[model samples]
Target: MPSSAGPSIDTITEGGRVTQVGEGQEAEESVPPVMTFGAPTAGEILAERYELVEHINNDSAGRLVWRGVDVVLRRPVAVVLRYPGGDSATEMLQAAVAASRVIHPNLVGVYDAIDEAERAYVVREWVDGQSLREMVADGPLDPGRATAIGNAAASALAAVHATGMVHGNMHPGTVMISQEGRVVLADARTDGADSRENDVRAVGGILYFALTGHWPHAEAPLRGATAGHGRAAIPDGVRDASGAIAAPRQVRAGVPAYLDDLTMDLLDAGIAPPPSDVLAAELGRLDIPIEEEPYPEPAGPLRFAAETGDEPSPLASVGGRKVAIGIAGLLAVALVGLLIGISALGGDDDPLQTEPVARPSSSAPASGAAPAAATRKLSVSDVRIIDPDSKLRDELGGAERVTDGDQDKGWDTDTYTQPNFGNRKSGMGVWIDLGEEHTVKSVQVSLSATGASAQLFAGKTDPPSTSAGDKLLFTSYRTNPVGQPFEEHDGTTMTFNGFDADAKYRFLLFWLTALPSNDRGYQVGVLEITVQGS
Candidate 1:
């Protein structure tokens, strides 16, 4: 029988019985062993492919977690086994299956789920790092790191929510941070009791925990407790006599004002939590380097409003910044109006024209003009791969690397048989969102290889961050290219200065028409992209 205080593996006896020892507790005497009749033991093989190696521990819900290996694939795996298959393990199995469908870098990959009459087990990617709960054990994390973890969790949940499914389980335990600095969300328990809104709110809990080393949801305990069953290993949020939990900033020093506002807003029941994607984008924007200030000096506490149909609430709009959620349609309208105004001014040639013009050396306001609208590097709020024709969505994983200010790491397309994406559906590109509209300037793209045919397009509206949305964007942008298309450019660096000086642009699509030949085949890599505008 599993103890009330979560089980920790001390040793596996030859009889296939696991010895449970509590952390910091010493074994004084040889304890009597419990029945091990139906329990899976060390060295047992399930599904003929997964060979159980070591028992990690038993979770709060009496599920056995083992560090296993896929004999066939020769990869380490985490095997979660629950006794008595059938109805008892329905929720676990279902959640595993659903999670398996969504493949994301920040989401732990669910390999296989099986039922062996007496027991049910789920085999998933074995993360080699500690959980958020464990990471914060020493102390709260820095605001930057906490923000990165929040961004990763939110991004993973956004991908999961895109499939119209709720994660139902987003907590410190589920948020895994690997040794390689990879943050992945694992152990989704979509038990139908939780809503998508709840999932979004859980991100707040995660952020709060990361910043304060305290679990906010004390009343409603999350999964994975190192000690007590159902209770989190982390301490509860510092609450007052009124039972109101203190904000992160109040608990920890150096927590950015915007991050504090965002975390508290998500935890606030009164204020609605932004959609996962919107929250993810906001977090991504905040996940900046320590050298750069996270946000403008705070005016007041930021708040979120209930999302109305088609209209999103003002999400993370602090210090008068216009960070509205789901404004793609409105952006499109704004773009259309701008184009019409430009067309009216430009004497009949379609304002939405794609004509190659002489590339300017600089976007600086010509000699002797008002100090050129102080060109600054505009931050990208969000980015996604627009692979409309591809069946595999695997390419969407590293899209963030292109803008991470790291040239060595980048996002690249799969190698193709031919230069033009193996002659498959037009071409694929990256979609970029600049949070809000900005004035005209130049866009610089750093590529890994030269001679790849590419085009830069600026759009008014943002699209849903999905495959279908990618298709719609691809079709729309291809029909009416914004700037001149670069056909077989000579070098890796490409600059587009065709942006209208007076026009304000928000979204951009960097569409690739062809690829450069590599040692493997034909492929192109976007090392880094920088937008210089007001």
Candidate 2:
């Protein structure tokens, strides 16, 4: 039988006995050696520079984390190693390189990424404290403390997004709190799989986990999750029948209202996630600043001798003068009051002369005389995704297609189980920026199928969500149905007329309510959009 040893070490079997082989030792046993795999041990130097000191833990991505030392630089470092290197090292190397480019106080520093044929590893800053995961494991964190950690993470993400990169993997496990109370985000896995919006949501998730001790993104693969496998096991977010996850406050007590709102907004898939920089600024404002304790007040009053003076002592002279002036001021005020009373009595006999009140000037037109402003063609740019159904379709359509005068190609929605987006959402629509606010008279749409219902919404700002059309632009529902359905052969030409012509409008939404097809998975295609305004 052959003795088993780690991949980093060599071993030999000597006649039914297993013996470990040291460096520069020839195999005395005639038996062949068996190969086994394990992590690098102490005194093992990787790439002839990093010496493994001790096993810290395992990362969520099935990587072993070790506390190591850079032999050349003589500095402490944390090394994350993955086995069977070569192809497996691709993502690890890519993540390391991307993270290394961003230098931020809230981001963990990356030193090197190396592959040694048998294994691949990333060397980074060694944080000598617990992960957010470890802290929350004991119990929930204080709301103020959680907010600070969130602010740091968001600020770090803003830096990452500024470079047009996304930190695809953001969980409590990745958030490190050093012994010095420094918050840093580690391990940015940019697989091009998750978008920048996911990064923002992850910050909210972190706060939720810190407060409620529950992971809102339940499917997240966390470190110490499985026994002797990955990292810690993160608890899943609680969801109701509609699949809507409850807010952090609903899950746990002591969560502040402001924090609850912020967390909920980030987690809301319906609304567009606020930009990273904007979110960072908001979090910054909410972060409670550390206050120093105030100095204790003196117990006794000062006892200072008055200076000998040809001129009186400054303090005594000033105090005496102030008292005399105060008495004189009171007498003068009484005399003035008597004179004012006498004048008012005399004015009562004659008509009191008064200045007229002035009215402020106004720029708005008088009632019922508002002119119908001249209209011009508006460009349809700044198209954005507003999928109410939460369908993850990146290639829905562009705003250019609707105004490009191309009947051949236009934007369409993904196939849905039901006609109305499976009742998961109120509706879906494409937003058209009119460049500036206008008096939108009407909008006409050409659809591929008949009887497709839609609405025209005009607003100043982009609609927060698909179902949120009612919240902005107009107080009531904006879903004004198009004209009667036409035959399939002729296609449908529906016009949305009679908009609030006096009301200012900038962003117009053509929201679809019902699909025309009776198929199992149905979708609607808008070929062209004609805007008539004045």
Using lDDT as the measure, the top candidate is 1
Q: Candidate 2: TM-score?
A: 0.47
RMSD of 1: 21.3
Q: What is the TM-score of each candidate against the true structure?
A: 0.50, 0.47
Residues 372-413 of candidate 1: C-alpha lDDT, one tens digit per residue: 243456789998888888777777779999888787889988
Which ten contiguous residues of candidate 2 have the minimum total lDDT? 339-348
Off by over 4 Å in 1: 1-41, 86-92, 222-233, 289-303, 306-534
lDDT of 1 at 402: 84
Give the runs in model 2 whose Cα sits over 4 Å from its true position: 1-41, 57-64, 82-91, 219-232, 236-243, 251-254, 290-435, 438-534
Clashing pairs in 2: 223-231, 223-232, 224-230, 224-231, 224-232, 225-231
lDDT by residue (391-469, candidate 2, tens digit) is 4545455746876766667777766687776676667676677777766544656676665666656555554544353
The residue-level lDDT of candidate 1 at 78 comes to 66
